[model samples]
Target: MLYATASQTVGPYLHIGLADRYCDDLTGDAPGLRDSRIVIEGRVLDGQGAPVPDGMVEIWQANPNGRYRHPEDERTHLPLVDGFTGFGRVPTGPDGSFRFITVKPGAVPDVHGVPQAPHILVSVFMRGLLKHVATRMYFPDEAAANANDGVLRLVPPARRDTLVARRGDDGALRWDIVLQGEGETVFFDI
Candidate 1:
């Protein structure tokens, strides 16, 4: 009988591998950037409403055409955009703010061919967390699609707002993430 070993804790040194300038941009040198430009900006807050300065945020999503870049995603009808890798990473600044510039992802189908809402898959890594936290950021404007999303329905109605990002006057999405306490962002096990 083999027992699993204890998990190791993450530390404040995530910048070494995750925050290198090369891995920070997802919309680099592409016309797609001009056409589908949007900024996802937010801060990572801790239980006491303080910024988690050492945290790192990573996002993965389908391209604007709803197609993933991975070879396993063999949907031929979906249009592919040049220079969009459907992934990005950024580190929290001194104030725990993080921002991602990328096109809004299109609706991807579920296992049963149901069209899920357009949303970005977010993962957060930081010191003191044994494992990263997983969440999704849905667009507040995608009301109809969001109403039909299978994953969004799982969250209780009252707390669901935590997952939706609001668009600002400048067209940037403001979606702050709280690690604990009231109004904490909903994290999924998977």
Candidate 2:
């Protein structure tokens, strides 16, 4: 038939084949769990400020030592953590909230060799989206470092707050994603 299949969006049934397991616990019993376990929690909201229950969120970051588990990372100076994969995927609950338990990531050098702020790469997949949205979550505590971050510096000052996660009362980080609205989170083109 030589016809291309139509593109389909990730609907409410994403959990079935994508991330059925409790994939959010990146530090569960892992060797690197004892030192710096931290929780990252947030909700995914739609344009009208309603929850997007069926969405899926995925995150990737370097270990505490700033070394990635991927083969493409060829930095010899960075130390890799044992038993830490630095990848997490979680399906949003009925309230559109997602959480992950992982160690605080270390700062990685930018393309110009300048140390960037500690951050996690996030991807959001949901119904009606032909492609997932990409963003970065920066730790709120790293204000100084974030100011010098190459990517953060490029973002308009007014919109930079959307990318920084706030520290909760219990010490966990909180960062919500607003897909569309007056305060929409800043998403990356990549």
Candidate 3:
């Protein structure tokens, strides 16, 4: 009998081995980056809007020139910055807050050659989940580009606001993720 193994939730101790790679800064003080640096800070909230203190958030994005650091990104026309890895991971604090410092990513082209909006791909891992949920953090300032993004178009108009991070008076981007219930964040099936 080939019974499948039971599913398990994501974590209670995600920070164990992951702490070594806990990078909150994608741009490691490297100069020559073509875009302005930005700070993104946010909280991971449960359905009731309480913080999920033991969660982790990971982000991947293209460089400021719209090129990824991965080998598969054959866009040689886009220059990669010297010290920017374009990837970051941060564990949530006791208040469920996480922060990242990086340059604003440029628009990357989709598979069909359509340009996506300047956005950071996010993955959330926490307790009570069989697997991580995927989402995106779009810049609120890039409204025109966001409007034309193929991926953003797939999200329902009424729910798209969940994906856009708002800039605060302090000049940092603020985005909160709600795991479930009312005003839940729009997570993708990927």
lDDT of each: 0.89, 0.90, 0.92
TM-score of 1: 0.93
List, residue by residue over 1-190, the lDDT tens digit for candidate 3.
8999988887697678877889998877577753578999999999898999999999999988899999999999889888898899999989999999998988899999989999999999998899999999999999999999999999999999999999999999999999998879999998
Total backbone collisions for each predicted model? 0, 0, 0
lDDT tens digits by residue: candidate 1, 64-133: 8899988989998897778888888888889999998888888999999899999999999999998899
Q: What is the lDDT of residue 116 in candidate 2?
A: 88
Q: Which candidate wins on lDDT?
A: 3
Query: Where is model 3 poorest over a 10-residue stretch in terms of lDDT?
Result: 27-36
Better of 2 and 3 by lDDT: 3
- TM-score of each candidate? 0.93, 0.93, 0.96
Off by over 4 Å in 2: 1-7
The global Cα lDDT (0 to 1) of model 1 is 0.89
Candidate 3 clashing pairs? none
Q: Record all residue pairs in model 1 with backbone atoms less than 3 Å apart, i.e. clashing.
A: none
CA shift at 170, candidate 2, in angstroms?
A: 1.6
Q: Using alpha carbons, what is the TM-score of model 2?
A: 0.93
